[model samples]
Target: MKVLVLGGDGYCGWPTSLHLSDAGHEVVIVDNCVRRQIDHELATQSLTPITDMKQRVKAWQEVSGQTIAVEFGDLLDWEFISDVVRRHQPDAIVHFAEQRAAPYSMIDRRHAVYTQHNNVVGNLNVLFAIQEFVPECHLVKLGTMGEYGQPNIDIEEGYIEIEHNGRKDVLPYPKQPGSWYHLSKVHDSHNIAFACRIWGMRATDLNQGVVYGTVTPQTERDPRLINRFDYEEVFGTVLNRFCIQAAIGHPLTVYGKGGQIRGFLDIRDTVRCIELAVENPAEFGEFRVFNQFTEEFSVNQLAEMVVEAAGKLGFEARIDNIPNPRVEKEEHYYNAKRTKLLDLGLQPHYLGDSLLDSLLNIALEYRDRIDPDVVMPSVDWREGRAKQRVHKAPAQPSASL
Candidate 1:
């Protein structure tokens, strides 16, 4: 299969690109390198040193003997995306090109607007590009579990069958997105459903959970091919952040009562889920939704797990309860259905097993790079003031072209 991985230089996108390429699919990466730029703007860097695109793909080719083509462009530009679609005519497109941080989106008005425009408009362009060129191409879009918010019911895959007013209808799950970034994803989901209904397009919306782990089979091949491990307030995920804190002997900062619960999966499972979605394409005129996660854990549970994992390595880790920066329920029912991926042959990797080797040890390995200042809650959900200084990210070096 010829696959085009948009935002293929990003944390999840980079590893997914390599996984597909290694599985013998012809992969072409399309990215503007904005993620790297965002790190520059936040005065933060990946805890693990990541190489540039040239070095990354070059190392992958040498290690796996697979060629993954890369193109420098933005998805918001219709002409650019349309031309690429027409030229490549890929069998599938794994769309991962968008601003993905919730806190960053909630920072200020400008950031909010940028997140929505970049994500919503860019997704629209991808839909139009597919409609124009490859109507048969399967679109594997990355949606977020955050889009569901904390609904007071068991969240179905993407829709629910409800009997309201003596009539039964299956509808897209009600979205209560907590941040602008998640709202953009909800908007994208609606747009894709509309497109599938009207244009006979096929798509699989993977409402993926928070991903953890930094190592995959492809990434372990070389140091330069390593993936990003971000542990800052804006981009760092909860479990990853806890691991970093434990490694640095800092208390795991738990927002509010730390009862907030969400789904999580290892980086290895993420790549496999992508493969499962691609291998079994959604039917034409179908917009399939899969709750792509292996396990669920509360914020407090994750902190405890990290503490125990740290103890095994001769480090004492503690938890600190802080005021919740975001407006959300600290405690709520969060039983979400995630059987689709498992049915598709996904062997789950529990957080307990990977806690030490995959996360804490990696943090320990890079202890020198861990910055304590950016570890705590910085963004305020009530106030729209930007937490981190916003700067124009410098352009990627021309060698990537």
Candidate 2:
């Protein structure tokens, strides 16, 4: 399959692009380097030293001997996306280009609008590009499980069966998005569903969980092929944050009671899930949704796992229950159905099995790069910036390293 990967330079996008290319698909990466720019804006870098885009592609080609074409342009540019679609006529297009951090989105009003404009408009352009040039091309969009928030009941993949007034109908599941970033995803999902219904477009919205790990088969081939491992307050997931703290002997700052639960998966499984979705394209006029996660754990559970994982490497890490900056349900029941990809032969990488090799060891290797200041929560859900930044455990001295 000829595959077009939007946002192919990002954390998930870069690895997925390589995986597709290694799987014998002709892959083209479309990105504007906005993620790198954001790193600069935030005065933070990935825990792993990632090479530039050109060097990354060069190293991958040298390692895998597979050529992946790259185009530098924003998705908001209709001409660029439309031309790419017309030129490649790819069998599938994996959409991963968006501002993905919830904390980043909740930073302020400007950031909020930017997140929506970038994510929603970019997705709309992709839909239109497909509609105009390659109607048969499957759009595999990266949606978030956060779009559903934490409902009292079980979360379906994307839609739910409802019987109202003695009539049975399946409707798009009700969204209670917690942040502006998630709201953007919700908007994109609705837009994709609309396009499919109105124009017979095919799309798969993969509502992915919190992806952990910094390595994949393709990324492990070369150092330059290493993917981004964000451990900052804004972009870092809970698992990444905890592992980084453990690496530097910083206390694992668990926000609130640490009862917040969400689904998670390894970086390897994330790429495989993409391939599975691409191989099994959704039908025309059908917008399929797959809850793409292998395991579920609360924030406290994740911290505990990280502590144990770090202990195996001779690191002692303690948990610090901090005030929850984000206005979310600290404790909620979350059981989301995720059988679609499993039925499609998704062999999941469980957290318990791969934590040491996938995350903790990487954190220890890059212990020198761990910025202690950025490990704490800075963005408040209600007021954007918190009244006071909390840093209970300062990073251990570099001399100790």
Candidate 3:
């Protein structure tokens, strides 16, 4: 199968591109290299040194004897995306090209607007391009579990059968996005679903959870092919952040009470899940949704896991409960259904002491590169809320599709 991986320079996208190419698929990666630019803007870089795009492709070829094509441009440019789609006419398009940091999105009004414009507009272009150039192309969009935002009721896959009155109808799962970044994803979900219904396009919206780890089978082939490991407060996931903190003797910064439970998956499983979605294409005129995560953990639970793992390595890691930067439920019911991916033969790499050890070892290798300032939270969710108690703002409220 011919596959096009958008945002191929990103943490997940880079590895996924290599994985698919290694599996004998003809792969082409389209990216604007905006992630690297973002690193510059934040004054933070990937914990693992990353190769330039040409070097990365060259390294992959050297390691695996497989060639993956590359296209450099923003997805927001309709002509560029349309040209790529028309030329490649790929069997599947793995869409991961977006501004994906929730904290970054909430930093200021400019960042918030850019997040929406880049993510939402880029997604729209992809859908329309697919609709016009290759209606049969299967779009595997990267949605987020953050779209659900700790719903009180058990979170369904993508839609739920509700009996509100005397009638029964299945509706798109309610989206209570926690930040502007997540809200943009929610918008993409709605737009893609509508496109599928009206234009007979096929798509799979993988409502993915917080992805951890730094290496995959393909990335492990060469140092240059290594995926990005971000431990900064704005871009890093909780588990990865904890591992870095443990490595540097920094306290595991658990926000608020650290009872904020969320789903997580290894980097390996993320690539596998994308493969599964590609091989098992959605039906024409169908917009399928899969909850893509292996396990669930709270912020404190993750910190404790890191602490225990660090103890085995003779490192004293402690947890520090900091005032929450984001307005969210410190404790909430988070029963999200994730059986679809497993049913699709996803053998998950569950978080264990060994896995934690591997992550810590990686962080320790680059301990000198760890900047103490970037790891600490800088963006407050609300103005003046960081120092004083103010009226709590609602979690970015949910919108009905």
By TM-score, who's the top model here? 1
The residue-by-residue lDDT of candidate 2 on 1-401, one tens digit each, is 99999999999999999999999999999999988877766778999999999999999889888998999999988988899889989899999999999988887666777788889999999999999989999999999999999999999999899999999999999999999999999999999999999999999999999998889888999999999999999899888888888888889999999999999999999999999999999999999999999999999998888787777767689999999988999998999999999999999888773555458888888999988878877788888532344222111111221
For each candidate in the order shown, give its overall lDDT on alpha carbons: 0.90, 0.89, 0.90
Clash-forming residue pairs, model 1: none
Q: How far does residue 44 in candidate 1 sit from its true spot (Å)?
A: 0.9
Q: Tens digits of per-residue lDDT for model 3 on 1-401?
A: 99999999999999999989988999999998988877777778899999999999999999888899999998978999999999999999999999999987877666777788888989999999998999899999999999999888999999999898699999988899999899999999999999999999999999999999988888988888988999988788888899999998898999999999999999999999999999999999999999999999998889999999999999799999999989999998889999999999999998988998999999999999999888888788895222221112211211311
Candidate 2 wrongly placed segments (more than 4 Å): 385-401
RMSD of each: 3.1, 5.9, 4.7
Measured by TM-score, how close is model 1 to the native structure? 0.97
Cα error, residue 384 of model 3, in Å, equals 9.7
Q: How are the candidates ranked when ordered by TM-score, highest leading?
A: 1, 3, 2
Clashes of 2: 0
Q: How far is candidate 2 from the true structure (C-alpha RMSD, Å)?
A: 5.9
